[model samples]
Target: MKKIVAFSLLVYCISCSPGPEKNKDKKAERKKEIQRIAVKKDSLQRDTIEFVSYNDDFDYSQLNGKKGKEEISYINDQNNDRSFLRGDLIAIEYKNDSIYIAGDGETPQNAEWIVSAKKIKDGKVSKFRKEYNLPIKYHYSKEGEISSTYLDHLYKLAEYYIANSKKDLIKISLKNKEQLGYSVEKQKKNEKDYYVLGIYVEFEHRVSPFQWLYIDPETDTIYEYDLPNDKLIEFP
Candidate 1:
């Protein structure tokens, strides 16, 4: 009887104990789990932000029904250069029984000049606001009156950047075929709202590095984002 009980206990212990093949399989599964976690971490590090394109949401024909005012010389042309005469009044808008005509001024400074049409009503001049440099945040509506050119506005804003300034240098080399697209985003800092226009350049020919240009439509502030180097300009 003692021998029989001892043999039965030994058989039960042998069956409960883990074998070498079971231990190997467990180790392999643990290694596979660790590798999956590492791969997921690498993927998260690689994809920080995804890029997206913006739609052009402007309509030019909204100004068709409104009558155009006579084109006049630009105000605040301190240098006496009449370059403002080349561009017409951007648009005439009617809201709340008042007419607002917007135009660009000749003096290209840190801020472009804007002359608010003095005549709030039809066919009359008030001369209230002259050579005002208000930041333009006008939105074009199909029913409302507005006129804007996306390309021309961007070019006009680009002229404000200093070509020789060290801060203005964006050392991004573009391929001959690579083209850039832009989007406008609204952001806030220090309780102030700002309109930021982002320029994205495609670089498929190279190792597919990304670069971006950010411009503030309200303040005409400029910055370049270097993604590969992980550099971003800190602005006040």
Candidate 2:
């Protein structure tokens, strides 16, 4: 009777202990829970912060004639690192957890001006950089005598502005050509004539103008129509 009681106790204890398969299952569940928490934390961080670009506030004219990967020096903006000036639209590359700027037939170097940002929209990066240097062309045109080259440049300028400002909208509306297009017209502002590109959209056969961008053909300065204030403001 004593031997039988001891054998029964031993069997009960063995059955109560967890097996290898059960331990493996518990570990997998814990890993999944950890991953879920990590993803939630990342999402919260993204909702509260963002990255953007701004002007570096340095004179880049001294580097103009210096060509082919010439080492240049300028004071970096402490507040905003992703800073660029007008006419600094150089090529950029991302590699090995760093951003590099490449020059013509030269080795890539670390881009110190490019910095991370918070609380700014992603599209603002492109808008802060001026991408176009409009060519000098004739503004004078007789009836049916407008040069195709002039019209082409105006269309390109309008497209560039739309890409910088209306990036999200264009991605969805670009399938329909009529939904995203521009029209060139001669208009007078401040007693001076200017070539204006009317950026418009067509929906349900109805055309609606969204942006009025005026350009000086001789100087290549761009102005945006301020509808509420009833004036033309210089565009970035």
Candidate 3:
């Protein structure tokens, strides 16, 4: 009887010994998963502020000869990072991370400034050397804190949002007028919702900076904007 009892106790000890081994393996696996996640997240964050380009073709006759340079400007000035003046009608250009906001009139807005909220990325921005006596100048305007090349970014952001936006209703606000925000809504014949793009005009009517949002519809491509009474307006 003594021998049989000893043998049973030995069997139980052997079974319990494997539990620690299983726990050790689990801890090791957890560490690997965490490391993998850390790497992926780091790489993903780097992708947001990549360098981009903006191209414009026009007869800069009026503003030429003043700077004795490439009749057109390529220098982007956050304060005036662009190559054009405040009232230039931008036919077409390409730049990275640009956004578009709502305007009070149908014609392209004469924005001498851009409203920005995002911080500049260190590596993504072009390095403007001090040696180049470029046509850029640093000055203060009535609107205060405006960037010339700022709209370059605004346009890029607008294009990006338009590309990725899955929503139907977009609301926009124009600073010059206290009327209300504008709407970019696309309504389909058979769909209940529409796609919309909203924009802001000024921070508080003094500047021309704007930021807005869009909402994803439920199996719909377009919808009417349910604008807040304070920020609603009609656009032709």
Question: lDDT (CA) for every model shown?
Answer: 0.35, 0.49, 0.33
Most accurate candidate by TM-score = 2
Kindly list the per-residue Cα lDDT of model 3 for residues 11-78, writing each as its tens digit: 98998786877989998997786555433311111111222333333311112111222233322334
Which pairs clash in model 2? 81-115, 82-115
**Cα deviation of 142, candidate 3, in Å:** 43
Please write out the lDDT profile of model 2 over residues 5-53, one tens digit for every residue. Answer: 9999999998999989999999899778655543431111111112212
All-Cα superposition RMSD per candidate: 26.5, 20.8, 19.8
The candidate that achieves the highest lDDT relative to the unseen native structure: 2
Question: What residue runs in model 2 are displaced by over 4 Å at the alpha carbon?
Answer: 1-144, 166-178
Give the lowest summed-lDDT range of ten residues in model 3.
41-50
Position 12, candidate 3: lDDT? 89
> What pairs collide in candidate 1?
none
lDDT tens per residue, model 1, 96-146:
111123452221222112222222232111111122122222222344222
